[model samples]
Target: MAQERRRRPARGHRRAAAPRPPEPGPVLELEVERIAHGGVAVARHEGRVVFVADAIPGERVAAQVVDAGRERFWRAETVSVLRASPDRREHAWPEASVDRAPEQRAGGAEFGHIAMTRQRELKAEVLRDALHRMGGVETGAAVEPVDPSLAPGVDPEAGTGWRTRVRLHVAPDGTVGPYAARSHTVVPVASLPLAVAGIQAVAPLTRKLEGAAAVDLVAPAEGAAQLIVRSAGDRRSSRGEPPTIIERVGVRRFTVDRDGFWQVHVGAAATLTSAVQDLVDPDRFDPAADNQDLYGGVGLLAAAVGDRFGANVRITTVEADARATEHAGANLADWVGARAVTARVDRYLDELVAAPDAATRGLTGATVVLDPPRSGAGRAVVDRIAALRPAQVVYVACDPVALARDVGLFRAHGYELEALRAFDLFPDTHHVEAVARLAAIV
Candidate 1:
């Protein structure tokens, strides 16, 4: 009978159970086997992988599990070193030393405890491994130091005081300092050894820094240091227009917003410019072709191309930031054929893909230089760039794994790696910059 039909439970009617909290665990004795990407050492416990921080490969350390919720892996930090690697040293930044409690150590100097030479060697190993495993391309590229001549009066070997940009955080209670390693908790510190002298002179580390949520210290190569304080709810905006600053790479000067993006190391700009110049052969540069720089910041790499070719060289710098595009227009004003367009790179390439035959022909023999962010140019962007069929592509990448993946995608599109060079731009850290030249298989 119809009256006998009972009401049934609706979909999602029952409340789901909450996830169980990760168990707090006893400290473990672990032997680190090798270094992995992102400033962590690989160790295994109970047949599961554990990423341990503050420990070097070939060392035994007692660590505390910070996270164990994941079924495949756990995260830990070294509490005490039972057996240290020969390459280990007193950390360059004492405040970030492993001797400190896990939650108290400063971030941004994850590799500070290792010797500089060994640090570069480890970076090289990481790069080569990524290229081989992910990109299927074998590389012997070593992470080299920025040339001493580029940064005169600075000690390159010391690997300290090279950073021209530094950011500090302010807690809700108004205490200001660098955030703790792997956390947003601000840890007050006495000194910032990685910052250049100019930044150190104006650092507001000891002050209360009231009414501000963050501070940006910028010390351009040719000018006095500038401190920008950002309020709690302001995001990146200010009262009026953000102030602009002048940055010098060799004799040429660039106008960059104080809040704009720039290479942090003093010599990074020059080193990259030189590397790009060396990678692009002058004879291959077609002045009539539509050369382009993707994610171009203030026309730095485009200027590198102009420096290698003539001022009459045809090139366009595409950037998402309007302010950076404005600066790029001014910076590249000397080049008659150079223009800066404000657009997302993928959209810009999409426009190129749909262009008329005459316009598309300009891209066929062109050279494309892309310095993508840490995420690197993903699969979609790589596919778009490949469709353009540029004669040559210069890829400047900061993350090894991302670069390797994109390189693999390019390989599938009949593009071959011609050359690759890595630079130790961010010393005492797991970060490395790589420049690769790829040519179409004709």
Candidate 2:
């Protein structure tokens, strides 16, 4: 009986134990060195570059890699701050906090965690880096905040409530909020701190609209506030009717479309208008000076130039969007020699380059001002402007990288970057406005 029991037990002996799967790698601990463009902090870990969102400079952070599988660089968000910077503050917007999940981070202000002064410093550094790295141009001065006098009408202390325009995504269930950063997922917002008084007023009411795909709120300095609701199937409506707003630049009035291109910041329009007028110095040029405003949205710059030149300078505004061009014409109707031309900037420049009569084409010793989109004026337009031998070219740029690229193009055509004035028109974000003065190297 003992032998039989032993044999039976030995036969049933052991099943092999399962091998355990490999354990996941650890979350990295990194010292953030500085803030980079696009509202991220730069750090290095074990010789690999890391970009940490929602972290400030001089902070030690535990970051979980969100992207970068076997890549040279990694994208991460701060999981925990081992050591925090003095510049770090509790985020202004509750949705921008690090404790919030990644999907909830899509639509809040990027610099909500940074101090106001430090935010400007970081933006200045970004502007400097873009100029030096992309355009090979060394700035004599860093990006500067706009002078308070430039926007006297606006309360300088009301920086957070300066956003005159805001767009929010509408969820399927009619919840309205900002789309999470780089995601289509809606992050329901009970309050938007960055919005102006008018937008904040309408944000709550948006939930009442059915089948809404998106909602836009605009509050102009000189007009009634309006809301635009775009529903599914492209149907659009406002509270009452399609709304238009008037923007006042000096004594000039511009009727901008409710859905069209306009500066989002409340102080931006006035600051930009004053900067353009100062840089162009229309008074310094001859009365018959040929001036062009390319990518002129609603003729803001054109009107400014015309006002300074007193309707004597032949000013032509080129706009690509039909809606914007129509508004531009209306805005510039009061100026005698100012006209809006609806054409792509490149095509308009090409026509100027190929015109048979240079004198008749208004290309000789002319001065040009271009407030191009974020993509910039491009090399072809720069070349054409050079061929025309303009005395000066004033460039208003929203994207530093694009401005740097076009600056390099201008340099290739023997144009020198005379002056660059970078303004903190867009605070609490990575965006800055730059007015670049390029003079022909005569």
Q: Which is the leading candidate under lDDT?
A: 1
Model 2 accuracy (lDDT, Cα) = 0.73
lDDT (Cα, tens digit) per residue for candidate 1, span 303-409: 99998888899999998878888999999998999999988888999988887873447378899999987788889999998988888999999899999999999
What is the C-alpha lDDT profile of model 2 across 46-132, one tens digit per residue?
899898888889999998777766678778877788998998877766776777876677565888777778887888788778888
Question: For candidate 1, what's the RMSD?
Answer: 9.9
Spell out the clash pairs found in candidate 1.
none
Model 1 regions more than 4 Å off: 1-24, 235-237, 358-362
Model 1 Cα shift for residue 334 (angstroms): 1.6
lDDT of 2 at 37: 70
Candidate 2 Cα errors over 4 Å, as ranges: 1-26, 106-108, 147-158, 205-210, 235-242, 281-284, 359-362
